[model samples]
Target chain A: MLTPLFEAVRPIPAIALVPVAILLFPADEQGIVFITFAAAFFPIMVSTRHAVRALPTLWEDAVRTLGGGRRHVLWHVVLPGILPGVFGGLSVGMGVSWICVISAEMISGELGVGYRTWMSYTIVDYPAVIVGMLTIGLLGWLTSAAVELAGRRVTRWLPRAEEAS
Target chain B: MTLGITLESLSLGYARGPVLNGIDLTIRPGEVLVIVGASGSGKSTLLRALAGLLPAHGGRALAGDEEITGASRERAMVFQDDGLLPWRTVRRNVELPLRLRGLPRGERKAVAREWLARVGLEGHEDRLPRELSGGMRQRVQLARALAGAPRAVLMDEPFGALDAQTRAGMQALLLDVLRDTRATVVFVTHDVDEALLLADRVVVLGHGGIRTIVDVPGPRDPAADRTALRAQILEEL
Candidate 1:
């Protein structure tokens, strides 16, 4: 049911929303942040939805027959079932968020990596643009890694690295 | 004490139409009843109806005199797929029922350990379900179902996917466990050999209500002088 909405939202490039964001938001900063959130939200939603939809129907039946009600099943089964995929989505979402946010900033913003890159280009400051690009890349990598690390910690019951493969 | 179940004019199916029509039978407490049939014969449908999974079509199932409105702890089901939560360890999966029932953690752990051992998964307690072989995973599922000490265990082709040797081993393990516990079992399978080995009374389901319910005499071995019985069942199917 929610799938079609997600489908419609998933494919359109976040950069396509530049005009819409500029018109909707009162300030460039807020507009960029909204774009960043939009970019992140769709990937997470789409990935998590697929994860949930792909779960075996029998697993829910198993819980029900064991005297688990709907709430019980959600907590003990559904949430745990989707965590790995959800975290995977989070990792991807973080990367895309950076992309959209920087693009929005470059289009129209006083500061941020994207704006800095654009300003450097205007002044022909090639080295400063490179540094901004590098910093953005580092931040994105660190955030994604943090999410992956958290996923590993919580899902410790999963088989270890070698056994998983 | 184990619980007996009665079904009266039970019709079951999906939204399109009824797959199983007019299933009326009583499973005695502590009895091992195996239902056998070809595909689309509604054997699995009947099992699901009894498990309170299939919504009421024309009639209802009763646990003793009480109508089975929905799933309850009295009836636990073992699915064809080993429905182990991938995120939990084998021991934790077995402990799930106890945890749901709000048992004290220590007692739940002990019971989980005992049942895991019974299923020959003693040392593999901490391992996740993904790490286990298909046969071992099925064993863990069985242990989890039985650990609840439920009155009835409804199994739908729990060993159908295993290799012949592994299927035989699992069948033997199930029989051993069933013999030791008081839980009544309604095992569904397409394999005639499996039905004969496990059933005290083998029920062949087809054309709606039970096609036939045959009482197997002592020595429930497929290799025994059961050619006559096998022929009779095959003929019915």
Candidate 2:
């Protein structure tokens, strides 16, 4: 039911929502957070939906025959089955969120990497700008790595085909 | 605690069209009834109706006194694909039905381990389904099905995907396990030899309904001469 609305709003880039976030929130900090969240939310939601739909009906039937009800199917089969796909989405979302957050900070912020980078640009401090850019890249890489590590830990039951060697 | 299954003119099909039309059969308590047919002959469809996974298109299917309106723990199904939860460990997969039944965690664990040992899958409980061989995975599926002590077991070519050697081993293991449980077994297979080896009564499904029902003279006897009987079943197919 929410697909239509989600589809309509998804195409509007999260970075472009800076003015709207500024108007909606009382502080720039809240606006920046909102923009970051918005950037992350769509990828996660779309991937999760696809994951749920792609699950085999056989699993649900197996659970049902074993006397499991709707709630049991949801918890046992659906949630765990979608973990790998959800993690894929989370990784993408983390990357996208970093881009949006940095952009939002540069557009409207008193402090942070994006602001510092923009400030260095105005003052012709080329080395400081390079440091800020490097910091942003580092932070983005770390967050994505964290998500992937968590994903592997949770879905450890998945067979690691390459590990056999 | 085994349950007798009666199909009173049961007609099964999908939204496209009917498969089996107005079929009447009685699967006795503790009896092994093997359904054999060519492809698209509705053997699996009939078993699904008994398992309550598929609704009867025109008639009713009864498990003991109650009508089989939907799936129940009393009738557990084992699929050709094993149907073990991919993300769960072997032990956890076997414990699923017990967990669904609200069994306490410790008791569920103990019972799961016992079932796994019975299927000769001990010491591999912590492994995932993907880590196991096809034969071992099928054993896990069997363990999971019987863990709850269901009154009836509906199998849809459970060993059909296995190689000949592994299939024979699984058949022997199944006979050994069936000796312990009195559950009525409705097994579907395309192999006439397998049907003869396991079935007390062989149900030949063809041309949209049951073609014939043959009673094996002596079931589960590997040394028994079954050439004539095999020929008769093949003729029906």
Candidate with maximal TM-score: 2
Model 1: fnat (fraction of native contacts): 0.72
Model 2, global lDDT: 0.93
Model 1 residue B216 CA deviation in Å: 1.3
Per-model TM values vs. the true structure: 0.90, 0.98
Clashes of 1: 0
Per-residue alpha-carbon lDDT of model 1 for A74-105, expressed as tens digits?
Answer: 99989988887798788899889888888888
The recovered share of true contacts, given per candidate in order, is: 0.72, 0.83
Worst 10 residues of 2 chain A by lDDT: A156-165
Candidate 1: C-alpha lDDT: 0.87
lDDT of 1 by residue, B65-149 (tens): 8999888878999989778888888999999889889999999999999999899999999988888899999999998898888
DockQ of each: 0.60, 0.81
Query: What tier of docking accuracy does candidate 1 attain?
Result: medium
